[model samples]
Target: MPTTSSARLAALTVAAVCSAASTVVLSAPAHAQSVRVHDIQGTTRISPYAGRQVADVTGIVTGVRSYGSSKGFWMQDPSPDADPATSEGVFVFTSSAPKAAVGDAVTVSGTVTEYVPGGTSSGNQSLTEITRPKVTVVSSGNPVPAAVTVDAASVPGRYAPDGDSAANGSVNGLPLRPDRYALDFYESLEGMNVRVADVRVVGATDPYTELWVTVKPDENRNRRGGTVYGSYAAQNTGRLQIQSLGRAADFPEANVGDTLAGATAGPLDYNQYGGYTLVARELGALESGGLHRETTRAQLRGELAVATYNVENLDPSDDTFAAHAEAIVRHLSSPDIVSLEEIQDNSGATDDGTVAADETVGRLIDAIVAAGGPRYDWRGVDPADKTDGGEPGGNIRQVFLFNPGRVSFTDRPGGDATTATGVTEVRGKAALTVSPGRVDPADPAWANSRKPLAGEFVFRGRTVVVVANHFNSKGGDQGLTSQYQPPARGSETQRHLQAKAVNTFVRQILDVQKNADVVVLGDINDFEFSTTTRILEGDGELWSAVKSLPRSERYSYVYQGNSQALDQILVSPSIRRGDGVEYDSVHLNAEFHDQISDHDPQVLRFRP
Candidate 1:
């Protein structure tokens, strides 16, 4: 459930250290046979000698993590095995601060444990660690193993081998093919020291002192110097998360297009959040790429601009109101209608049963007006307390902000959190039974999730139906780097149902009056090519506008190191059948360290 990169890193480290807490320690025999690191880490994902005690394991310490709860030292065997599938390095987990230093020749005797980074339920690959260590300094100043260079040529082009069908798509039992797949290649060097020279920073440095770098610079490179994740097949093998083992304050703060100049070498560790990670022991200096925030051109006179921005849990207490206001006024070019997601209640997460967001919305509106933008009025139904899921008591919901000068909101009565809005023919025109109403809020698809908010607007004597949605996030889904091949996306079931319900509602509106201008937009939390999207675009009911751009320019969010489309805008056939529509996924956020929001706002302009 850790959302941020730093949180996941902390969680993984905590889980790894605590994995041996409940383990029953088994002492080795008096004359146990000496074992090499590769003997413990076999050709498979799981360690061969797991749950057994190994004595007299000889290796030279390569890196030492003395800080934090996960205090341990990474050691690499100078003498390696002939098999390329097995790793030469291993982590010696000490309950407290380790007494080992880098480059020290040491002998360790401990119970070999297959520590799953997140947990067994996470489907994350396990780390072969030696727990309950009995360390002895054999000699001083012995040379460490040479760091393996991880460049474009070293990492295989293929991502991972498909799992065995009989075992429910799990590759844990499969033999490691280091030369064939990138996942296998990384697993082959699981605990080994690896280096990447002058790697480009694809993911910006987050607050948790972690960033992402790619050895394959040219693979799916975007205009903004990011690796575009177009589909499930292309996992961008070279993208690896980098976390410095040094001080957090000393960690280099980098932007998306920057580069880590010189060699950044470290023990390759598999994390719960971002699969393969290089925990930097030899840190690199940050070289700026001069990346800057972008601005979109203002909407034309006849075009009504609509945009969607997930403000990252905006509330009255947040100091980001001014920055978000500037992003709306400057970067977004002041869209006529904007759908704001994650707008917390007036009390934020205080859990005082305050469901109203008037103060929060009012502060943002005031900031916009102060920033030379129009005084935008907002419309949204307050959800029943704790019914909507977000930050525990935040009560986050989708709210619509419209500029009255360009468009007018058609307010109808009898709309609330539990009320379901229906489309009806009024004077031979498509109309909502209750404007600013919930779309099938009672449906099971919306349980513990935000319901779709549908509203009617008048623009230049034409009626436009806009539905703002914040679908269920992909929280419980296994990541792309999961041990299971292709990974399981269990969270998609709810999203699939959500998409079906939205598509059904849109169909109802179009059935009432053909050629109705309906714009559906928000943080969909799924890829553009996903089944959820395909369901939303059922038959010919709706089409995603982000796909109108080239494949490289279709991303509104960045996760790990891949630029992906999570926030999107889809329009009905009436709106898509013309040449007047224009869409822009404004690159204001998601690529910089000082972003006001985590998601980039998407704008769609068209004549109704």
Candidate 2:
């Protein structure tokens, strides 16, 4: 549902164009009056008179947008509608520059339509609009409808309604519950002016001139000022996307927990990226949360530092290598070993037969060394052609980069890209039969997905088994702002299976040596409190290093206003109980617009 960063960027452009269209003015001849906006926007998700021509729809122009192909202006009825569920305002899609001005009492003749942004194939709900309009400015300088208040207490707890069983999980067929459902409340205020107060920024201000805020306080709120994406709790009930479409300046940069001091006024809108957004023209004063990019963690003398970072599909062709290298050196304190995910093949995303990532991995190592970090050695199993699901021929896989001077690779024979590595007893200690090997490469859980890359390293006379992983993503899951009730999370099923596979492998190492030092690190693609994480830590066999930090400082990623942990560093119980096992989520990325990756690197430091 357009959860990717690119999708957010695209939405930003679309919102900007639409906002420009809504605020700009043009000239048109007058036409006769027809239907009320409330009659067109009934108490349902879909317009009742969709596809029918309605004449003389009268209202005061509240907003005008004249920039994009889907240009429109918002109009609100001065009088009232008996049904509170029905909205008194509506958007008139002029399909060009709008010919109306704010506060102009206008009459329009048009066809009522439910135009789905991004078309019907996008799985997005349709927006009710009046298209092919004939506009008549009946009178100018009329008072517009007063904005309605939509704060935490006034907002409904529920987000969706259960539709008919035959409607395929959609609430489109259901009657509106404006006072009970957040989606219904938004639909009720569609095109009408509304104000949100006492709002806390849940999502950081992104490059797209948009931000996400929550009217209600969350349980896992970070002290630094962002809501932790804890287990699926409130379902983002109070979270709202704020798009300053018609503003003269870009929205100010904000971190999680920052507050908007005054009320933000705008018309509620539905778009492709997020389901419902506030197309704000006026934003209140922003109160800072004192959130800033964190500095690199200190590497202690006796501590062996380990970290996990998702490079967000790095390839030899991408120019982000140098910036990423600097972040690894300066922001992550040059960990002794780093688990890198999403290393693409040498040819990048090209669908060629080339599957090796030597060039891709080598360039990063060179960049890291050039950036004043340790000269590192790397090991990884290139996936079998394109069987691993990723950017097709890009063949994204996890790899380990270790500082050769500090740690030695336990290089045993029989390691390849496709063979599964087995645990064996060696000299009365836990050891992998092949030092750099795949963990159950052919396992069904890893079908069409990147397999776990297992490597054994020797640090200060002690052996540490590090398993690097990049599991399937949440690509197929429905967004929290979906029209479907209890949004589908189908992607978690694969992740759940993948977690079990990794957990079983960890169990194998523990069975050989109960006190074995094992660290599972990479882009796990799930939260610490998620089911996938719980399965990976089955029976407390391993401990998540993130929990080592206070509850308010455990996020490694941010999306749609929620700061969450997706990339994780989990250590076996022995490591957790060991001395000097400190953990930190280095926030050089994720919270900033000029980020190197969508994920923040996490480090676990301990003396084993």
Please report the candidate that would top lDDT against the real structure: 1
Angstrom error at residue 345, model 1: 0.3
Give residue 76's lDDT in candidate 2 (0 to 100): 88
TM-score of model 1 (CA atoms): 0.97
lDDT per residue (tens digit) for residues 1-608 in model 1 = 54344354555566343655423222333334579999988999877677777899999999888765567889999999799999999888896789998889999998788777667778877788888889999887877799999999999999999988987788887999999999999999998999999999999888777899999999999978899999999999999999877777788878898999899998988767688889998877899998888899998888999999999999999999999999999999999999999999999989999999999999999999999999999999999999989999999999999999989999999999899999999999999999899999999999999999999999999999999999999998988888789899999999999999999999999998888999999999999999999999999999999999999999988899999999999999999996689999998889988778889999999989
Q: Count the backbone clashes (under 3 Å) in each candidate.
A: 0, 14
Task: After superposing candidate 1 on the true structure, give the runs of residues whose Cα lies further than 4 Å from its correct spot.
Answer: 1-10, 15-32
- For each candidate in the order shown, give its overall lDDT on alpha carbons: 0.90, 0.81
- Ten contiguous residues with the weakest lDDT in model 2: 20-29
The residue-by-residue lDDT of candidate 2 on 1-608, one tens digit each, is: 34333345344333222342322111232343356888878878777777677898889987776654546788888897789888988888776678798889998887676766654544566677877789999999998778888877877877667656687787876888888887888888888888887688887776666788887775356766676776575465777888764642546667666788888877787776677777776787888777677866677778899999999899999999999899888888888999999999999999998889999999999999899998899988878888888987888999999999889899988888778899999999999998799999888989988999999999999999999999898986777766666677888999999999999999999999999999998888998888899999999888888987876687889888778889888999899899988888888788765677889999889999
**C-alpha RMSD of each candidate structure in angstroms:** 2.3, 5.4
- CA displacement after TM-score superposition, residue 174 of candidate 1 (Å): 1.2
